[model samples]
Target: MKITVLGTGEGGRLHAAKLSELGHEVVVGTRDPATTLARTEPDMMGNPPMSEWLAAHPGIALLSFGAAAAAADRLVISGIDGASAVNALSGIKEQLTGKVLVDYGIPFNYGVSGPHPWPTPWGSMPTFAVLDSDSLGEQIQRALPNTHVVKAFCTQEQATVVSPGDFNGGDHTMPISGNDPEAKAAVVDLLKSYGWTDILDLGPLVSARGQEMYSHLHSAIGFALGGDRRFGLKVVR
Candidate 1:
């Protein structure tokens, strides 16, 4: 499988490396490959630069967004940040047509202060830009009408997501929502390969609203767990 992870962030790098380890041809997408390779300092989240990561992991190609999307066999994991996702993806619409786009981003608007802000070690927690009525999944699906967008992985950290067995014998639940059943199934298959045993089909892109909105609670849980513990939320049915 030729997979494209469309971002240079920590999450994107994790997916790219893991997918490569799983024997898939992985390509990471960025706005400009040269600029990404030129970075010397860590990213905002303190992850090592892309060039540093690429040097450590060989054979994984890094390309421009359009080229990366076009190179994918069928799947694309979008790790682009929420604020600029729509615009960045919209620019490469043609390359993504008819492909399954797995969106795991929360639509967080850090610039706008929430009505009641929750402060943390970093700063005040960011508020959702699209809440209650709309979601980033729906927005991406609309932006690329021909693309199949399935929402997954927003509820947990990327490391935990790619390797669930590291926590609680992989007993946690992974919730996915999308309008297209086939696309959702493809994403579920990917999750299974990553060792997920309890994947919940939350039904339709609208369900992404709840999946994404859970980020606030997720943050609270992290803080309660001492801010660095890796834990999973299980749906105890």
Candidate 2:
């Protein structure tokens, strides 16, 4: 599949590299194409010389602010903060029409310091305020009604989301919710390509509220477990 990965931070670049390694044609969309080019070269694995890395991966496309949204079969926006994803996609809503968007975002307020606060109902977990009334995924769907949006990969930490390691007990499940069945299947196939064999369908886009909140629990677990981001939860029979 021809994929355009938007954003140049660790999450975005990691996905781009993984997709490229999986034999998919990947075009990286960054505000500065030169920056992406410089970071993806062969000799630059450890301490990549900024100049050489840029010179090596010429296939990486440098997109203007709005160009990334206008191009590609699928757009995976990562690395950037949640608000940036909203702003970026909002600007290119028209271009994203009728496309399948794989949304992997969480509403986390980094500005809120000192003690993690739980903001949901007694049994509920806190999520980004945007998700309180309407989730980001739903908002994106609303903004681009023609676009098929599937919310997955939001519950797991970046490491677990990318490489979920082995199935120790029962199959580790990533909850996926979408209004479009075909879009959900497409995302499932994408996850399978990344070695995920077990997926739990949480039903409809509205279930994304639950899924996003579930991620908050995962975050809390991570915090309590001493900042280890590699662990994941499981449901066994």
Candidate 3:
């Protein structure tokens, strides 16, 4: 399988590396491939840059948005923010036509503080920029109607994205929302191959509101439990 991961952030780079490690042909799409590939220093958050990660995943190629999008068999819109994903994809909308897009963007502005954790004095709660009426998934679908968009991996931390079996309880469930049945199944199967055994199919792209809206709870839980890594969600039905 050939996968093209878009965005230049940690999430995009990490997913590209992991998928390439699994023996897929992976190419990363960046705003400026040359500049991104020339970095030697760590990122602003102190994680190693994409240039460094590329060292370990030498099989992967780095290309500009148009080139990468044109070459990929599948697409992963690993946008750091929902708005950026929508904006960036707008330029190459035609390239995404007929491809399955696995969107991992949360539709909230990170500049504003998230919802206050429980038991704290309630005040302004975090609000969604694309909530109540639509979601990031729905927006992408509307923007690229020719593409099959599936929403997955947006509600979890990077550490839990690939290896959900690390949870002691066994299969931790992953919910995917998309209008296309085959596209959603492709996402579920790809995730299953990555060790996520239990997956919940939340019907239609609109259902993504429930999954993406989990960001508030996710942040509150992360703050309440400590840092945001090494945790997984299980639907205990």
lDDT of each: 0.94, 0.67, 0.78
lDDT of 3 at 106: 85
lDDT of 1 by residue, 51-118 (tens): 98999989999999999999999999999999999999999999999999999998999866678878
lDDT of 1: 0.94
The reply for model 3, stretches above 4 Å from the true place, is: 75-77, 113-126
Q: Point out where model 1 deviates above 4 Å.
A: none
Across 1-237, the per-residue lDDT of candidate 3 in tens digits comes to 888888767777767877877888988888898898788898776778777777777888888987888888765555546867777887788888898888888876644545552343343444578887788888888888899999998778755777666666445778889988888888887887778878889899899988888987877777678744466677888
| Greater-lDDT candidate between 1 and 2 | 1
Mark the 10 consecutive residues where model 1 has the least summed lDDT: 110-119
Q: The CA-based lDDT of model 3 is what?
A: 0.78
TM match of model 2 to true structure: 0.78
Best by TM-score: 1
lDDT of 2 by residue, 180-226 (tens): 99888888888887778779898999888887767667756776777
In model 2, which range of ten residues has the least summed lDDT? 118-127
Cα lDDT, model 1, residue 201: 97
lDDT of 1 at 129: 90
Q: Is candidate 1 or candidate 3 better by TM-score?
A: 1
- All candidates in order of lDDT, best leading: 1, 3, 2
Runs of candidate 2 with Cα error greater than 4 angstroms are 32-59, 74-79, 113-127, 166-170, 227-229
